[model samples]
Target: MEYLKRFLKSIGWIARGVDLLVAPLTIISGLSFRAMKFIGVKKFPINNSLFHKIGFFPIVNHYYEPQFDFKGYSQKIRHFEGIDFNAEAQLTLLHSFEYKQELDALPNVKSDGGGYFFNNGSFESGDAECYFSLIRKFKPKKIIEVGSGYSTLMAVEAIKLNRMEGEENMCTITCIEPYEMQWLSDIEVELLTQKVEDADLGLFEKLEAGDILFIDSSHIIRPEGDVLFEIFEILPRLRSGVLIHFHDIFTPLNYPEKWLKEEFRMWNEQYLLEAFLSHNAKFEVVLALSYLTIYHKQEVCDTFPVYAKDAGKTLGSFWIRRL
Candidate 1:
């Protein structure tokens, strides 16, 4: 059965290559599909595989965007229906100013004297700064970061600073990453070299009110996928007041146009989050970094003059407190 599965997979790749080689023909078929829809055809007889083969996937995506209204979703959560997301962002912005000096003091791993290094890869824009600031401010007793990397380094630095200040209840950090980096191995935090979905579910249940559940997931949801497991199982089991951080979540807007058309990053984790938060009052928005960067551009620039140049752009680091 395994050999048959592999054989089929190889054949599938060959078929995909053939489809791409005849892309012009496929695109013509896609145009026909669009015409069929225009003629009031309720549904096409073809499935997604056929759509891909006929080069209609991108067209379908462009025309029939996700029904979830991301702008309205952001607006609803930002308003004070239960928690004032804007006010929380404002408060977080204020606290961020205090941490600049300390953040600037952390030794840069790649370079010297620039504080924590940030770029397009790993942690970048204001997300790195925001994570560092939040860790210092909240002082979570325990931090369980799911997809770890540069953020782990930042969190470790924050914990170190907390200990240096002689805080009695210093936070302990743990990282769960299946594909570990060389730098990740050197970090002092407890490392679980496995997927979060496969890790013991009880690890999340142990989290109390003042902990952090940091998630930088695969961003793709499938049957029995990690994103589904975390959303359905881990989130519901966490205690109230626990801080939750989701990476690459650009709310108030859908995934970037460039990402979809150019980069082809078909990430839908934000959509899942939108669905989860729609009518549920169990969670409250704390700080939406992308939302703040776009909507509260001036404030973000003022708060971190060092990152002022990148203030106009969006960064994907969202924080929510369990209610």
Candidate 2:
């Protein structure tokens, strides 16, 4: 009986290894066909150069102000210590993460309404910068990302840079998406075209501590409880020192004034982390930057103060750690 059990476990591992090897190629093949249909021809050439030049001239003054929340931004949330909110500090941090150069080179995607889209879909410039910085800092061995978009590209770039810099560990990525995007076909990430809650997380059984788990898929379609439940399912399987990033935490329900567009108002999605924190006392906030919040399993041990604009104002990102 013992031999039979061990043999069955070995078979499972072998099957997963085969999946890891072939999934990316299969996904890329399907995505290539899809891309031919959707992105083969452009309706109009998106002139990002002209638009970016205009972006230099601030047309709206209110954009510089701090965003307001339902608690009026004075809710006194706990934040990481020693964050400098000055312009110089912001520039320095962006430079440290190589985000400034990347942002400058990004192309602008034009929507049907004649508006420009940056950082793929959903993620803003701030979000991209933060994710890049985190990837560079931690060098997570396994990245389990639940969403497929520009962030996928950014993560791949970060991993490649890490390898170039002589990081001996090879980082592998697994992206879970119900609907795959064509641009991601260029990368070698394992693509799972299924709901995150339904996908087989046993693939992560080999991931040790300090791996990254990023969640940024559906915002409104699933109930908040369902989302939290899925998180609960995955959390216990992870190592304690692993980093988990959750996107769209700063939703309209909590922070109303921080919204850049009217579409955000209709998102009507709640941050599941808030509820997760309320019930479970295991994780702590590493940082909360504009729609993105990072967390980990451990006591807080950093002196970097969270950089907020002022009283009744929110910073683009802030860090919180577990107690």
Candidate 3:
């Protein structure tokens, strides 16, 4: 309490007119120092991982990143372990506010008379914010999102916000969601209010070149888990420059549970990443928050192996172990 009071007092002093003259300059100086330090810390860019169209923001999700020198930060990250706020803490209060902003903008349309929420299946406010911001930053001509709920609607919310702010030059977005629970009619209703047209039905099966994908679906199947990606094997058709996103890559929503123990297994990002590398490479984890994984295929490899049956199409699965 005393430390908080002191911090608050310090903030008040910073806000006061007496300090106001020096505050902005001092703040700028502090930011400059931090920027220098961040650059100084092993200055490794994701040049190798960036060839792919994927765009990730690691600072937002606070997910475990193999980079950021985990061994060094492990002590620091664990130092304030129990505190609500840590230097490593990714999402900010601003993220929560953004989520509410998305929620508030949504229209209450009912296909079956219940209040319906719309968003890309990524339902968390912060996760949605992370995705939407990446979309703006990446400016992908083709985009893909994996999991969604009302959060996909939040993306549409972001589109509305972008148009209101006038970003006509931004790239087109296509989100692949397997669950048909939301029903196209409700989605159409929601899009109608936003001046956004209906979603493309071909989103799940295939996409032409210059597209990106979000893999928020599932690594495993469950009664509760509707979308299954492990068995789906849908990564081949995406073009070389496609941006791929994976949600829940760091965390599990009660998987390996009583109901789905037979169907569940531990997931390793390394395995999945290596698998992705079979076809594409050059990547970096931009957002470490919410177990987020974003990668852009720098170039589609020649070894993506054409299936025996359909010589024109790629094989079903590319395993990290086999290749």
> What would the TM-scores of all predictions be?
0.73, 0.53, 0.38
Worst 10 residues of 1 by lDDT: 68-77
Q: What value does the lDDT take at residue 215 in candidate 3?
A: 56
Candidate 1: misplaced stretches above 4 Å? 1-97, 106-109, 112-116, 167-169, 180-182
TM-score between model 1 and native: 0.73
**Model 2: per-residue lDDT, tens digit, 169-252?**
579898887674754555788887777777776865555666777777555534543365446677667667677776666521
Model 2 lDDT vs. the true structure? 0.53
What is candidate 3's lDDT per residue for 222-282, written digit by digit as tens? 4333232322234443434444555444321222132223432443442344344433333
Q: How many residue pairs clash in each candidate?
A: 0, 16, 48
Encode model 1's per-residue lDDT on 40-134: one tens digit a residue. 44466565467666554433433465432233232223332333455655666455557767655554456753234666377864788788777
Score each candidate by Cα lDDT.
Answer: 0.74, 0.53, 0.37
